[model samples]
Target: MPHHPAPEETLPVIALNGPTASGKSTLAVDVALHLAAHGQPAEIVNADSMLVYRGMDIGTAKPTQAERRGVRHHLVDVLDVTEVATVADFQDRARTAIADCRRRGVVPVLVGGSALYQRAILDVFEFPGTDAAVRARWEARLADEGPEALHAELARRSPAAGAEILPGNGRRLVRALEVIDLTGSHAATLPAWTYAIPGVRAWGLELPRDVMDARIAERVDAMWEAGFVDEVRRLEAAGLRRGRTAAVAIGYAQVLRFLAGEITQDEARADTVRRTKRFARRQLGWFRRDDRIAWLAAGDPGAAATIAHDALGPDALTTDAPQQRCGGGEQAHGQRR
Candidate 1:
C-alpha cells in the first residue's frame, strides 16, 4: 500500500475516538498499518488524558509496545506520574506532535476518549483564564462540603456544566465551578463544535448498548487479572497521590481506595465495573453531541475499511461553518440504525 498524500496534499488527521473498550487503539494501529501498506505512512498520537502519564500502563488500557507493530506512537509515556495534564497543555503538545508527524511525511492518527481534549486540538475553542483565588475557593469548598454538595451547588448555578460533569469527578467539577465563578457561566460561553484546524475528521466507534456494557465489564475483569492494582501501587510510589489529574483516573482512584484499606478487593472490583459502565455511558453522550463525527459500529468487520475509505477516498470530509451549530448529520456509517 502506498502512503497517503502528505498533510498539505490531503487531510492532516484522522481521529479515531470512542468510549473505553471500543477498540480504538487496535483500530488506530490497523488503520496506520493499512495506510503504511498503501504508501501513506501514519503514526498514532494519543489524545487520552490519562495515557499521557507514564507507569499508567495496565489500568489505562494503554497499548503494549509489541501491539504497536513497529508503528511510531506519540504522546504516550511522556509525563511522570507527578505531573498534571491540562487541556490547554495537551492541545499545544498534541497539535505540535501532529504537525511533526505531517512534516515527517506521515499521517497523524489522533485517537482517544477525551472529547474536550480532541476538540481543543481540532476546534476553535479557548479555555477561560483561571484565577488562583477563585480556583482555591472552589477547591476548598470541595474539601469542606464534598463533591456531592458542590455538584448540587454547581447544578443550581450552571445546569449545563453540572449535567456534563460527573459528581464523583471532583477535579473537573471544581474546575467547572471555577470557570463559572470566573466567567459567570460554564461551557455556554465557549465556541460551539466547529473544527478550527483544517484537514481533520473524526470517526466515532460505537456498539450496541448491551455490547458496550459487556465490553466494559469484560475489560474491567481483564484489568484486574493484569494486576491493575499492582500497577497502581507502583504509580503511588511515583507520587500519584500528589498528581492532581493522574490520581483520579477511574481505576487508579478505586485502586487507591483499596490500597488505603478503605474498600475490600471485591468491593473495588465491583465499584470499578459500575463506574466504568457509567463513564462509558457518559462518554457516548458527550461524543453523540458532536454531529461532525461520522459514527461507525465497533462490531462491523468493514468498519476500518470504511474509515479508510472515508479518509482516503474521493469524498471530501467537510465541517460546518464556524458560526453554524452542530445539531444535524450525525448518522453512523456502516451500521444498522
Candidate 2:
C-alpha cells in the first residue's frame, strides 16, 4: 500500500545535526536565510535541550540575537533553569512548532546536537510505558545509592541504551529502568531509522578528530572568557542547582563544582574541556548509528548552499555555491547542542 501523506506532514523540514563546534546552529540560520531569499521562507526551531532554558546562554553557546541574523526561532529560552523537561515533553513542543511553520507555508529547520533528543522529535518513536511502582522503586535507589549505581544496572540490562544516557542523569536513568521494568526491555536503544513525518531531510557535519578536539578546546576557552562562570553564578542565584537536568549539564556541572569550592577555576576549565571532548565522541557515535543522515566534511565552502538547495529545490539559491557539501562520509552530525 502506498503511504498517503497528511496535510501538515507534507511540508519540508531541514535538519542540520552534528557534534559540538561543528556549527549546526550557524548552518541552521544560514539555511533559513538562504531558503527565504530563494522564495521558500523558513524558520529555526531549536532542537538543543540546554538552549531551551533561559539564562544558560554562555555555557550553551546559544546564538545571540545578532548572530541569528533576524531569523525567527522557536523553543529557545522557553524554560527557566529550575524547570525540568522530558524527551516526550520536547517532542511535543518541537512538533507543534514544525506544524505551525507548515501551516503558514514556511519551512521548519531543526537544529541541535543531542542525537537521542533529535530522534525523539523526528523519528517514529513511542516511549515505553512507565509504572509508578517501578519508577518509585528505581527513584528510591537513585536517591539512596546515587545515579551511577543505577546506571551500572542499566548497562547490564541494555548496554546500548545505557551508553546513550549519561551516568549523572538520575532522572533519565530512573525512567529507563522504569520503562524496562514495565516492558521487559528498554526501547531507548537505537531503533531502525524511520521518520515519523514525511519529507524530513537531515544533514550532518563531519570534522577531522584533531580539528574537532582543537575546536572544542577553543570553544571551552572562549566560554570561560565569555564569563561562563558568571553565567552559572547568575543561574545559581536562580536555583540552577535545584534543577536535576540543568545542574548536571557538561560545562554547568564543572562550574557548579568550582562555585562550591570543590575545584579551582582552572580545574573547572580543564574538566569542562575534557568532558566536552568525551561528550563529542559520544555524540558522534550516537549519530553515526542513524544511517539516514548525509554526512558532510567540515568547511566545505558551499555545503550550506547545497543543503538549502536540497530543501528548497533547483530554484533554491541565487549564489553559485557548489552542490555537494557532504557525501560518502561517516556518522550523523552535532554534539550535545
Candidate 3:
C-alpha cells in the first residue's frame, strides 16, 4: 500500500546487473571481498533466473562454492527445473534475502545479468495473475493463427503492451492480453507495486559491444569445455524437453540441438554465440530505458566495488565486528545446514 523508500532514503542494497558473461559474478565476489576487507561484509544474492534452477550450474555460470570466497550467498539452486519460478516468486525470495541481510546489519549485494528477474526484484512491476481458461484460449489461438497473427491482434488491442512483449515470447504476449482482457487495463500502464524494503540501490554494469561479444564467445567455449554438453544430456535424461523454460536457456538449448543431431557442433556453437550477443543487446536496451540504475563500465572489479561503496555509503557493508540480522540476532551463512 505504502511506497517503498527510494535509493537515497535507505540503508543500501547494492545491485550489479549486466549481460551474461560480463563478469557480474566475479565482480560481485570482488565487491564482497572489498567490503570484508573494510570490515564491512556483504552477502551476495543471486538475481539470475536460470541459476535458481537446480542442476543448471555449468551453463548458468553459477559461482563455484570456492569462488564464493567465504562470503554468504543466497537464492542460487533454489528451484527444481520442472517447477515454474516466476518473477513474482523471485521478488518474494529476493525481498526476503534483502530484508534478512539488512536486519543482520549486513549489506545485501544483488548480483546477476537477468534483466527481467533483476527488475522484478528491484523495481515495482505487477505480473498479471493467470487464468487457465484465458490462457488456454490464447494458446489455442497462438497455435492456430501463429505468433505473428497473435502479435498483430495484441497490437490492435493493446499497442503499448504489444510494444513490450516480443512476438517470440508467446507466454508473455498471452499474459499481457489476459491482463488487458480480464482487468480492462493495459499491462504497460500497470502501477508499480511497492516491494520496497528500505535501503536498496541498483547498479548496472556495462561494456563495449565488441568486448561483450568476445566475452560471450569465450564463455561459451569455456562452458563446452566444462562439460556443458553432458549437462544438457543429463537434463534430457531427467525428462526435460526443448520447449520447456529450463531447456530454452541460451547455451543449454543450443547444446541440446547439437546433442540431438539437429545441428553440427560448429553450428550450435555459432548459434549460441549469436543468441548470447542478441541477449546482451536486449539486456543493455532494457537497462538503458530505466533511469534508476547507476551505470558503471565493465572492468576492474575494485573500481565497481568502490563506486558501489561510494553510492551506498561505507555502512552498506557489514563489518565483522558485530552485525544484526533482519528479525533479530546474528544469523551466519550455512547456519541452517
Candidate 4:
C-alpha cells in the first residue's frame, strides 16, 4: 500500500527548547499528553547532541524509559560512544523522524538544549560540503599561527561570523574560514531564523539566572550521586576517549579529567557546574537571537499545554489532527543560531 502524506493543517510540530536542566523533557511529555487529549498522537524526537550516544544515560540526563510514559521517542541512544554526530547528520535523521510521524498522522515534538541542532532540523538551513584538504590546511595554519592570528584573518574576511565566534574558538573559526573560502562569503553560510518547515512552532523555557545557576549546581551534584563518574569509566573502557565528539561532552570531559588525576572529583564537579552554567547561558544566547520562538516561564505548569495548544490552534482539540512535514534545502552553517 502506498502511504499518502497527511494534510498540512493536521501536521503541526511543537519544538520545546531551553537551557540544560530547565525541564524541557518533562514538559515535552506533558505537552504530548495534552495534545493527545486533543486527538493528536505525538512522539518526541531527540535534539540534544550528547543524548544520542548510547550508555551516556546519567551524565546526559537522557529521559528514562519509564519517564517517557508510553510516548514514543526518536533519536535517543542511537549512536555509540565512538561515533561522531555532526549537525548535518543530526538534521537529516531528525527530519526523517518528523516526516515519518506526520505520515502516520502523529505530531512530532522536538525537545532539547542544543539550539543549533534544533534550528538545523527546524530552519531552512543547509551545511556546506567540506574539503578535507582545505580543512587540514586551515587546521595546520591554526596550529602554527595560533587562533588569534587565524581569527584576525577570519575577521578581515567575514566580520559577521568573526563577531559571533570567540577568537579562542579555533574550530569554529576554522570552519568559518573554510566556508568563506568555499563560497566567497561566510555570513551567507549560516542559517537565517526563517522557518522552512511549515506549521513548526518553537517555544523556549526561561528561568532567572540565579535559579538556573542553582539548578545546574543541584543537577551536577545529583549526577555525581547517580554515578556519572562510573558511567564515564565504563564508556572510557569502550573507547570513549577516541570519540572526538563524545569525549568532550560536558560531564564526560570533567569526569575524564578527574580520571586522568588532573583534577580531584570535587574540582571536577565544581568545574562541571561552572561549565554547564556557561553553556546554559550560551544556549540562551543562541535561542534568543531567533525571534520566532515564544518564551514561557519555566515555573509555569500550564506553559507547555498553552504553547502546544497555541501551535495547534483552537480547532486542534476538536478536529481530526493533521500532520506536519519537514523538508530540507541547501544553504549554510548553523551553530550558535
Candidate 5:
C-alpha cells in the first residue's frame, strides 16, 4: 500500500489563545504531547499577562513543572511582581523565544488567554513610549481624581483611545493619556509596531459562555482548595498590595477582598467566578474580532491538537525553514477592534 504523504509542512509559530478558564493551558500541553509523540516536540511559550509575574502561581493557574510533562516552557514567571510589563515587552520576549525554538528545531507554541499579549506577540501594535515623570504625574492624578475622572479627561483629549479603553482599565487609560501628552499625537495614529521576527500560524479556542462560567467556578474552587488564599496572603505579607497589576488579577483580587474581611469566603468564591467570567468575556470579545485566528471549539484536546497540526503542518517542525514574507503581514493577523 502506498503511504499517503502528510500535509505539506510549514514552520509554524502556533498561538493557542482563549478566554480565562477556557482550558488553553491544558489544550496546549496536550498538543505539545501529541506533537512530541509524532517526533515533533513543541516549545510552549507563555503569553498570558499575569503568568509573566513571579510569585503568582495558584491563582494564575500556572502549569506545574510536572504538568509540563517534559515539554520546554518559556517566558513564564520571568518578571518580578512589582515590575511593569507592557505588551511591547511581551512581544520582544516571545519573539526571542520563538526564534530560539526555531533555531533548535522545536515547534513554537504560544499559549494563553491574554488577547492583547497574544496580539502583541503575533501582530503589530505600536505602543507609545512612556516618560517616567509623565507616568508618575498621571499616576498621581489617577490616585487623586480616580479612574472615572481620568477617563473623562481622556474622553476629551482622545475619544478614539477613550472609546477603546475601559474606564476601569487604569493602566491602559494612563498610558493612552500619557502618550497624548508626550507625543502630541492621538494614540490611534501612532506608527505600526512590528516584532522583528518570523511568522507563525496562530489558533484560538472558543467556548460557550455558560460552559466557560461553569468552568471558572470549578477552577476557583480548585484554587481555593489548593491554597489560593495562602498564596494571596504570602504576596501580601511580602508587601504586594491591591491596585497593582498582579493584585488586580481575577483570583488574587477576590482573595484580597476576602482577606480584608470586606467579603465572606462565599462572596469571594462567587466574586472570583463572576470576575473570571467577565475577564473571559473580554478576552473572547478581543480575540473574536480578529479574523486570522482559526477558532477551534473547546472540545477534546486531541481534536484541538488535530486542528492545530492540520493548520500548522509538518514543515513547521523543520529548523530555520524559509519564512513566507507578506506585506502588512503584521496587520493581517491580529487587528482586534
Candidate 6:
C-alpha cells in the first residue's frame, strides 16, 4: 500500500453493476487483476446488501477464497445474519472503506447487484428520517391487514413509490408508509441520479433477456443442489427467522418457507428463480437511467481491458506507477445479468 495518496481531490471509483446472476464477482476479479498487473493497485469493495451477511454464501453466490484470487475484499461477510443491513449504515461504512483504499492509493472497485445500495454510495442520496412511532404503526397495520393493505395506502399517498415497491414486500411497504406519513411524500424506490463524486464510472453488463432468465433459473437450481436448504435450515436454527433482513433474502426466504412446510421444495425453487429474475430486470432498469454508465455486453471479449483502461487511463499501466502501493492478470470473465 502507498504511504500517501496521490494529490487528487478525489479518486475515481470503478463500479461493476448488473442484475442477479450477472457474474459480477468473476468480472470484478478480472478487472482488479488487470489493474494490478499494470501497476495500478486495486481492491474490491462489495456494494451488495445481501453479501454483507455471513453464512449466506451459497444462496448469495459469494465468491469463495479460491475465486477471490488473492485480492483483498472489503465489506464482505462483515455482518452476522441477525444484524440489520440498512442503507444509511452501509453508506457510511462503504464511504469509509473507499476513502481508506484511496488513502492507500488503491483503486476501490465497487461491485454489487443492489442498485439502491450502489446509488446511495455513489450518488448524492440521503435516506428519509424515520420515526419509531410512525414505523411501529405501519408495521402493526402490516401485521394485522397484510402488506397489500399498506401497499394500497402507499399507492394512494404516493403513486410513484407504490408503483416501485412490490406489494408482497411487507418490510418495504411498512417503511414506505412510514415515510409518507411523516414526510408527506415518499421518494421513488430508487434514487434519482446525481453522483456525489466526479469520475466515478459504472459499467453495466447484461445479456439477452432469455439467456439471463435461464442463468437465474440455473443458478437457483445449483444452489439447491449445493444444499441451500440445509444452509437455511442451519441458519434458522441459529435464529435466521428472527432476522428482519436475512429472513427475507431471495433464496433464503423461499427455502425457509419450504422448511417450515409453508411451501413445497419445487415452489421454493421456482419462486427463487422468478424473484431473482424480477430483481435483475429492476437492476437493469435502474442502471439504464444513469447515462454516465458505459454499458457493455456480458461475455464480450476485451471488456475487462476496456474497464481497466477507462478507470486507470492509458498511461497508468504503461508508465511507471506513482510512488507507493502493492499489486495481476485477468482470470475468469463472468458478469452479472
Best by TM-score: 2
Candidate 2 vs candidate 3, lDDT winner: 2
State the local distance difference test value for candidate 1: 0.81
Please provide the root mean square deviation of candidate 4 (C-alpha atoms, Å): 6.7
Best by lDDT: 2
Estimate the lDDT of model 5: 0.73
Cα TM-score of candidate 1 = 0.89
Residue pairs with backbone overlap in model 6: 22-335, 22-336, 22-337, 23-335, 23-336, 24-336, 36-328, 37-328
* Distance from true location, Cα of 255 in model 5, Å: 2.5
**Residue 66 displacement in candidate 6 (angstroms):** 0.6
lDDT of 2 by residue, 1-337 (tens): 9999665667678787889999888888888888887787899999999999999999999999999999999999999989987888899999999999998889999999989888989998777766788889998999899989999999999997788788877888998888888887886445667888777888888898899999999999999899888999999999999987788788999999999999999999998999889888899888988777888876776776778777665455454854434353211322211
Error of 1 at 68 (Å): 0.9
Better of 2 and 5 by lDDT: 2
Rank candidates, lDDT, best first.
2, 1, 4, 6, 5, 3
Q: After superposition, how far is residue 137 of candidate 5 from its true place, in Å?
A: 1.4
Alpha carbon lDDT of residue 51, candidate 1? 87
lDDT of 5 by residue, 15-85 (tens): 78888777788888787777776677577999988888878999988999998878888988897777777
For candidate 6, the clash count comes to 8
Off by over 4 Å in 3: 1-10, 140-156, 184-195, 311-337
Which stretches of candidate 5 lie above 4 Å from their native place? 1-10, 184-197, 261-264, 311-337
lDDT of 4 at 263: 94
lDDT of 4 by residue, 256-294 (tens): 989999999999899889888988998899898876676
Task: Kindly report which residue stretches of model 6 are placed more than 4 angstroms away from their true locations once superposed.
Answer: 1-10, 188-192, 316-337
On residues 1-337, what C-alpha lDDT tens digit does candidate 3 reach at each position? 9998543345567777878777788878787777776676588998887888888988887889898888888998787677766668888998888887776767788997766777777767667666889878987997798778888888999887777666655656666777778887775434453434444555667788999999989998998899888888888887656334676678777777798899998998888888788878887887777655656667743444454455345375343322221111112111311
Candidate achieving higher lDDT, 2 or 4: 2
Order of the predicted models by TM-score, top scorer first:
2, 6, 1, 4, 5, 3
Q: Which stretches of candidate 2 lie over 4 Å from their true place?
A: 1-9, 315-319, 324-337
